[model samples]
Structures are given as structure tokens and as C-alpha cells.
Target: MFRYLILIMILSITLAGCTEQVKVDMQGAGETIPTGSTGIAFDGKDLLVAKEGLIAFIDNIDTATAGSIYGYEGHFYFDRYPITITSKENKPYITGLAWQNTAGNTGFIWASDEANRRILKISPQGDVITRIPLTKIYPEDITFDGEYLWVVDSKRKKIFKLSTEDGSIVSEYLSPVPVPTALAWDGKNLIVGGLKNLNNPAPSPDNVQIIKLDPVSGNVMENVETSRYLTSPAGMVWINGKLWISDRNSGKIVIISDKGEPSTDIRSYKLPAVAPVLKKVEAKEDKNKTAQDVDEAKRAAEEARKAAEEAKKAAEAAKKAFELQQKK
Candidate 1:
């Protein structure tokens, strides 16, 4: 009888293991342009790209707008007029660029000056608004989430929320990635990228390891992956619902299909390398997370699941209300 009970227990354990869900690793694909720049931004009208000391404005591009499969835009064209930024000290090594086309800001951009440890508020037309100095932090890729500037610090492996008015640090969070690279805002959450970890080979959810973060608490959320399509997740920007990312070394800009498109036809573009890189700062090595840290991560994920369900319920309610009104 004892031997029979042991055999049943073993069988049950095997069945339970088989029933456990595994993460589905999915990624997108696209070709890229070797522009060797590591910055991507849209200045209301034109897509602005920058590297070491030169910034280029892409006025027109056969940018992929709609597609289900990853694009092969081998036959595409764009117009670029280079804008040279020269100074007596030295040429600016622009690591990142960000611009949100809002009221009163048409041509202005926020760029990372790696050489001087500063962020420059300038425009494509060669006008300077202000220069915010970073005491120690190295600014990598940057994104304007409508109100505040989100900056990535590669040396510390962290992301910072900075004040656009004065470049003051509002808040900071440890990047989910050990070797953090780029950042982008997807209407609601912040998407951060990193070097491919061959050891893990999968993100929290799965794939090329791009992570999404909570804007308020800086907590990490599930994010999209670049598959094997992207080499370096360098510079990223949200355009027309897709995440446009750059591979720094390969000089290829990779586009990822996101919210603005149907998942049935999701796509991003691989274009000219136009962005620079995320500069590092002097900082201590990263430490490992404790048990408490793991617990907090689990709680954050649970909260995210609840929030998503609530959002879905609200959308359904709104749709039903519209239907009732139509019947009336």
C-alpha cells in the first residue's frame, strides 16, 4: 500500500510539471540602415537623427506605416540635410536625442552631450535654448513622455526622470537590464532596451528583452522584444504607433510594431543608423536583488494584471453604453 501511494505521488508530480505554462518567446524582424548614429526623434514634422557631432533631419521617408510582417523596405528613399554643431571647446558627442512636438516647441530638441556631461536644448535650425549640466551621470538615450524627460544612465544602469525646465533629477530607478541601452515612451509606459543576454536568452515575458516600466514608481512591467533582428538596442522613439529603435554599432535603425497597429500587421522599420549611444558615468557595480526584491516584483506583476483587467472591463462597459444609446 505504501509503494502504491509513492507511485501515485510521482505520477501526480509528473502531470503537474507537464501542465505548467512556459513563456512563449516571440520577436519581430526587420532590415536596417548602417548610419552609425544612435539617436532618433521626431520634431513635429521631420525625423531628427544625430551622432558624434552632426545631426541630420530626415524631412521625408518612405517610412513603413502598415504591414503584418516585418518590412523589407529595400527600395526606400529619404531626404537628409545635415546640420553641423561646431564650438571652440570640442565637437559634441551626442549620445541621445528627444523631442515631443508640443505647443510652442516646433523645432527644438533635447540632446545628450556625452563629452561635457550635459544635456543641450537646441533645434535643427541651430538655435540654443539652454544647457543643463550633469554633475556625474552619463546620459544615454532620452525620450520626452509629453511632460518630463526620461534619461538613461548606462554607467549606473539606471533610468532617471529629469525636469525639462532645469534638468533636475526628479526620480531614478534601477534598470531591469544589466547592460541598459535605449528608452522610449509608448503612450502609457516606458520601454527600455538592453544588450542581448545569451545566458538568459529571454526577457521576463520572453524574446529580445526590451522592458516596459511604470512611469510613476519606476517599477518594471512586461515589454516587447526585438527578436534577433536588432544588434544594439541603442536609440528608440515612438512614431505612428511603432517603436523605432537604433542599433548603434551596426548603424541600423530597427522599427518594432506596437500599439498603434493591429497585432495582425505589426511592424517596425530598419533604416539608416542615425543615433549615437548611451554614455556611461562613474558608478559602483550593480548588486544582486534579495528575496524581498523578488517579492516586490511579484506584487508589481499582480497589480499590473489587475490593472489590465480593470481597463478591459472599462472598455467593454463603454462599448455597451454606446450600443444601448444607439438602440434608444
Candidate 2:
């Protein structure tokens, strides 16, 4: 009976090890993008980026608190070159990308082609599943909201919700900003970049913040300040209740928090006040100084009086000499 129980425990331990694959950072040692990578999507722990001329995936990365795209080492890349668009072969300008995690590693990715005016359904193995054409839509960034896809066009200032099956329009609404560069769905609200209010007479880019919108009513929920380091955000994703934004200018990904600065209890802070004992000491010092000043004043008055008497005697002697000279 003891041998049978030992054999069962050994088998269970062996099976558990076989079920999980060990994650190694070296698996993605060569999967890198040179500066122009924009469109970003995640597949479990892996990351997909639209490299300038191709789409690259970096495996075994945790971007939840990761700093930047270049901060990771090692990459295992599979490239799809000269992506076909509008029945023509060219280097596609892929702007926004969304990934739907499906069975095993057989999920699909949706990419917004800005220059070609279309959206593409692609397989993880770089296969083109389908393409949906767009009319007068200059798509900037895209995000997945359950069964629908949300595409933001900064030029048209419109957000479109589309069907994932055939990319048909489901609904549309006005964007909260004049130009929204990127969009992400944080479970409940749609987070968009570029928060300058052009409606105001003087608009500034320093007003750039994270703008949250209601997914259904298209209403502005709130606009929260982001770190000054974030500039020219291209794509964003929400994970672990924090927003991760990809910045184009810095070529890095940053975690953003909507909760502003923490409050402090200023009422508990008291200014240092002078004590009554110190005030009395200062008053005594002043009184002694005043006495010294009076002594100095009396000495100055005596000196002045002596000098005036000497001058009067000299003037009387001069007047008598002038009278003697007139008699001579």
C-alpha cells in the first residue's frame, strides 16, 4: 500500500512539470524594432509590434510595469514583408493593432492600415485572413471592445465601432478631442490621447492628458493628467488596472495612473511661534541698547556746544581787529 501511494505521487509531480513551459528571456533575444515601431498588441506574455517594414513579436515579456520597448532583450521574430493592401504589394503603414486571444496560439490580430485606408485580419503566423476597406477614414489607433473593434481617426475626429466578423459598421460617435492619436478600452471606458481643447481660443499641447469616454453614450467621463515624460503617445493597453502607453517621441512604454497627487493634512502642520520668554528677553535687550544710544546723544550735544563757543570767541576777536585797522 505504501509503494502504490509513492508511485502515484511521483507521477503527479512529473505531469505538473510537463504542463508548463519554462519562460526564458533569451527566447526573444533578436526580436527588435528600429525606432519606427508603432502598432502594439499583446498575446498573453508576448508582445507584437509593427516594425517599420515588418511585424515583430517579442516573447517572454511583462509590460505591466516595464519601462520601454528597447528595455527588453532577446526576440524571436517572424517577418511578413511588403504587406499586400488594396490588391497591391507595398510596405504597409500599420498604425493600430488589436489581438484577440483565442484557442491555444491560434488567435487573430486586427491591424488598422492608415495609409491604405483599410483594416486587416491577420494570423499569428503572418497570414492574411481578411481585409476591410474604409472610406474617408484616416485611422490612427484601434482597440478591441469585446465583440466589436473601436477605431479612432484623428483627421476625421470620429470613433467607429465595427463588427469583428466582417468589419461592418456597428455604431459611431464623436471623439472628445479635436485630434485623438491613440485609443484603448480600459474595461469600462475608452481612453484616448491628445486632450487639447481646440474649442478654446488659445489651445496648447501642454494640456495633453488622458481622456476617458463612455463606451456607449460617447460622453466624456474625465480627463486626468499624465506624466510630463509622456509625449506623442501612439498606442495604449490596460492591464492590472493600470494604463500602459507607448510613446513615439521617447520610443518607450510608460505606465500611467489616473489618481492624481495624494492629499496631505496641512491643518496638522503648525508654524513655529515665538515664546513669551523669548519676547521678554528681546524687550530687555532693546531697553539696554536705548540707554546706550541716549548716552551717545548727550556726548554728541556737549561736543557741539564746546565747538560753537570756540567759534564765537574767534569771530569777536576778528571784529575788534577790523575796527583798529579803520582807526589807523
**Winner by TM-score:** 1
Best model per lDDT: 1
Q: Candidate 2 clashing pairs?
A: 28-74, 28-75, 29-74, 29-75, 30-75, 31-75
TM-score of each: 0.61, 0.59
Q: Count the backbone clashes (under 3 Å) in each candidate.
A: 14, 6
Residues 1-328 of candidate 2 have per-residue lDDT tens digits of 9999999999999987652332223221222243546777776665667644366665444332234455444323332332333337655788888888776767888898887778888887677888888885787788997678989887777787887776666677776666687788877878877646545454343756567777655556676667665656677766666665666765556567754332221221112333424343557889999999999999999999999999999999999999999999
State each model's C-alpha RMSD to the native. 33.4, 27.4
**In candidate 1, what are the lDDT values of residues 221-321, reduced to their tens digit?**
56564544566677888877788777764455667765321122122211223354559764443323455678899999999999999999999999999
The lowest-lDDT stretch of 10 consecutive residues in candidate 1 is 261-270
RMSD of 1: 33.4
Candidate 2 clash figure, as a count: 6
Residue-level error in angstroms, candidate 2, position 211:
1.5
